[model samples]
Target: MNLKGVRTGIAAACAVVSLGAASSAAAQGQCSRDTLDDIAAKYVEGQKQGSIFTLPVGEWVDYRENGQLVSTATGVISQPSDFDWHLALVDTGTCHVLVHGVILKPVPYVVTTQLAWTFNGLGQIRSTVVREGDANFDAKKTYAYASKEDWSEIPAGKRDTRQALLALANAYLDRAGGGAADVALAPSCDRIDNGAYSTNCEPAPGAAFVDREFTVDEAKGAVAVVSNRGEAEGPQDSRIFRIEDGKIRHVHAVTPSQ
Candidate 1:
């Protein structure tokens, strides 16, 4: 479940080494929000088939599971199952989409997975990073959060600019890691790890050091952060924030690093 970084495993490590030298200009095609949504939907369907071959993808699509690169051929797509996509954040500007969902397979156990899908302008999948949790997870708690209506798109007037959204996410990370953060957390800010209820949005520092990664989706007031702990590496975590009256009203996370 905690497989570490893409630079860890043998096979995945090799891909990382070579892909670093791969030119980005070749895949820098522009993409639209609708296109990203369609791609995400296709991914959900592919998960059920246990093979993502149906989707438009490059010859060598970079794939990572739990930060570590797995067998591109038979790793995640090998398991066919029913997928329930709970929350989706589309960052058209970045040509990326982050989806929080659960993979339910009758054979073994249900798993909670957060998928970060990146696409080239040509609408083909360029990279996919999945953070999968344990097999056994709480369904009730997950449904409660996933069923909430607050996750919908924030109204334009209430929406924070991309910069502000990024700052809030950064501040929350700082506060969680014992750093002096000027952040505002909702009164009922709730956090979830895997599929279990974790905390009620408290300003408590966590054990590991958190490095603010990229803002995966500032439009929906959501951002993704990674922990930089020694060689083991930290989890690829994402959080969704609900803003009201210019203050953070609620917070939700999937595999929150803290």
Candidate 2:
């Protein structure tokens, strides 16, 4: 299946709106960096103690209850960004659980809604959460079997801090080129999102190509200033900031290429 076709529908617009809501919620929480750090530390501790069957989005947990060793419930550790966290309990004798939550960090930009883990007979953790998020914000909580191949898809090593920002720029370029389908490769992306631009651009397959040159500006937390020289449906030049994540968070256009 072409993931692009599915993603093209509202991925770009929703990403922007969701991010905005998240930012608003983060502001409302008034959670200081210290608070986030404390939470992170606590999560690490839970992992060390092996009590946390699964922790996703820097918060939230799913574990087996004591005694019966057949039921599971999810605990919310942080305020919801958009809506209250959702959980689905699965029964497999041992019980498998999934937790959904968001991680609102300055660096690693993550929005999780689906995370899975397994519990042992004694209600101890048997595995880590798999599939951190879903296409939509809905949480997927079920004890589905995960193959070895599933685990392999999990991202390894530290993510490129400049990815999200780069993606935003590339998204803009993709629109300028035509739509989401035009862009073949993942571009670096940062924070922020396209507004009207995101909606108007229809997904046109193989519309444009991007040749990017990046420089890390030390003064800006090693911010990546990207320049895109390419032809979408037409020629275009755009400047984008690269935030650390898998998707483009923000974008700006210097000259109209299409």
Candidate 3:
């Protein structure tokens, strides 16, 4: 699809995301990180094996890719891919995990997916990937920066609560989307997309962010930031963040070229 076509799709994909989590997930009770981590492993295995059934999913798992709601059976997860490597952001509070992987086969693709393990079962998955034609997409470069970055658990003393993490992330989107959002950045913070890297870390010149979704991992002080909609310019969608001691540290994003 062309760029405009991609933008149109994101506009439609915005309605159903529910900002990336189930409304009653907390009431339903959170799953242990270990359990969520296991489900994440199965998700990667599903990609490696190309079988959606590999997930212990609920009766109906809502799967949305690139802002379009599609069948899980025909989704990327069902497509067999040989990956160079994969990294996962596990969030226990909301029972969500965002998996970022670089696939080697079927024409290189950088896939960033967020799957929610709900009380009903493994439910809700949203994905945005940068393939060969995507703007600034260089799988090798993407892997180089993304893989080298550290997303390991934050020390207990330095960890921020889930609520704080969410606020910080939205603040980023505020600045990213062209609004005046007071966000902090560590001296080390860098925004990375596919294979491109930049220390400037600015979003589209005037493009706004909407249809946002977040997968916050308190343990690691990172959140998977998804601006489900696309922008006319600059990068938008699936910008993951790593925060430490009230500062933005690292960011990895998936979007069409700016």
The estimated TM-scores of all candidates read: 0.70, 0.22, 0.81
Q: Which structure among the candidates has the greatest lDDT?
A: 3
lDDT of 3 at 98: 85
lDDT for each residue of candidate 3 in 1-258, tens digit (9 for 90 to 100): 111111111222232332233334435466778767877888888898977655655545567677676665677776888678787878766677888889867768898888867665555677887787888888888777777888888889889988888898888777776788888889867987677899866555445677676788888888887664445332447878888898888887788553
Off by over 4 Å in 1: 1-29, 107-137, 208-211, 226-232, 256-258
Which scores greater on lDDT, model 2 or model 3?
A: 3
- Each model's lDDT comes to 0.52, 0.28, 0.72
Question: What's each prediction's clash count?
Answer: 6, 23, 3
lDDT for residue 24 in candidate 1, whole number 0-100: 45
Q: How close is candidate 1 to the true structure, as a TM-score?
A: 0.70
Report the lDDT tens digits of candidate 1 across residue range 150-219.
6666666766777777677677767766788877766666665445665466646764444434535544
User: Can you rank all candidates by lDDT, best first?
Assistant: 3, 1, 2
Find the candidate with the highest TM-score and give its number.
3
